[model samples]
Target: MHPAAQQAISTLLAEGKTPSVATVKAKLTEPLPMPVIIAALASYKNNPEAITHTAQQSQPAPAKPQSQLDRIEAKLDKLLALLEEKQ
Candidate 1:
């Protein structure tokens, strides 16, 4: 079972809600195969502890710096619009 699926199920359980395909799928950050989700649900039913494992902490992605080319492109676009307006 995918770790994300397990975490979703665990979260649902913690929230006092039963985990279903729709609910589990909705809780996932990324999409998983239907069969994989189904199998994970079944596995959870068989052993709830499997889904109760500690969730791993994920770090947020760093912000990307704006490139010089992007700034130049924006300036060119503005210049083009102004030129078009005067035409």
Candidate 2:
């Protein structure tokens, strides 16, 4: 199972062993339905590249599309100007 592979990877990492993708693939003796074992091993292998909660950024969000809002504002401005001209 994935848990077993995870344990193996964790142990290997703890023992300062840098296992390759093939090495991790060889560790899974039992037949599994998916590649969760591979994924778990990749997580260990690429931990530095993997995103984590500690790596979260604290910055403002990027700008989003505001065309609808701009159009509505233009319409409102036109209405206001029309009302002023009528009065």
Candidate 3:
């Protein structure tokens, strides 16, 4: 994420929401042109040293896209399948 975006995420997390990265990605995408978004992302990449995991400790909006939840769901499905296979 860009510093701006990272800053945005940290602001959200600070509010007590455990959002996903995708959510932050999506927030930046909203109503903004791609080039602007691209620039912001570039800005973020250029200063990665400044954007460590600490930003996640407190963010504005939830991270995003619910990828973690989805992954968990998929994992559970696989486990369920394995259990059925044993039966």
RMSD of each: 10.1, 18.0, 11.8
Q: After superposition, how far is residue 40 of candidate 2 from its true place, in Å?
A: 1.2
Q: What is candidate 1's lDDT per residue for 1-87, written digit by digit as tens? A: 787688678778889999999999988755699998999999988987655554434322545644557778999999999999999
Model 2 lDDT per residue over 41-66, tens place: 56755773332222234222555534
> For each candidate, what is the lDDT?
0.79, 0.55, 0.57
Q: Supply the global lDDT for candidate 1.
A: 0.79
Residue 77 in candidate 2, Cα distance off native in Å: 86
Better by lDDT, candidate 3 or 1: 1
Q: What is the lDDT, from 0 to 100, of the residue 51 in candidate 1?
A: 59
Error of 1 at 10 (Å): 1.2
User: Relative to the unseen true structure, what is the C-alpha lDDT of residue 11 in candidate 1, on a scale of 0 to 100?
Assistant: 71
Angstrom error of the Cα, residue 44, model 1: value is 0.2
Task: Please tell me which predicted candidate would have the highest lDDT against the true structure.
Answer: 1
By TM-score: ranked, best first: 1, 2, 3
Which residue pairs of candidate 2 clash?
none
Please report how far candidate 2 places residue 23 from its true position, in Å.
1.7
Candidate 2 overall lDDT versus native: 0.55
* 1 against 2, candidate with superior lDDT: 1
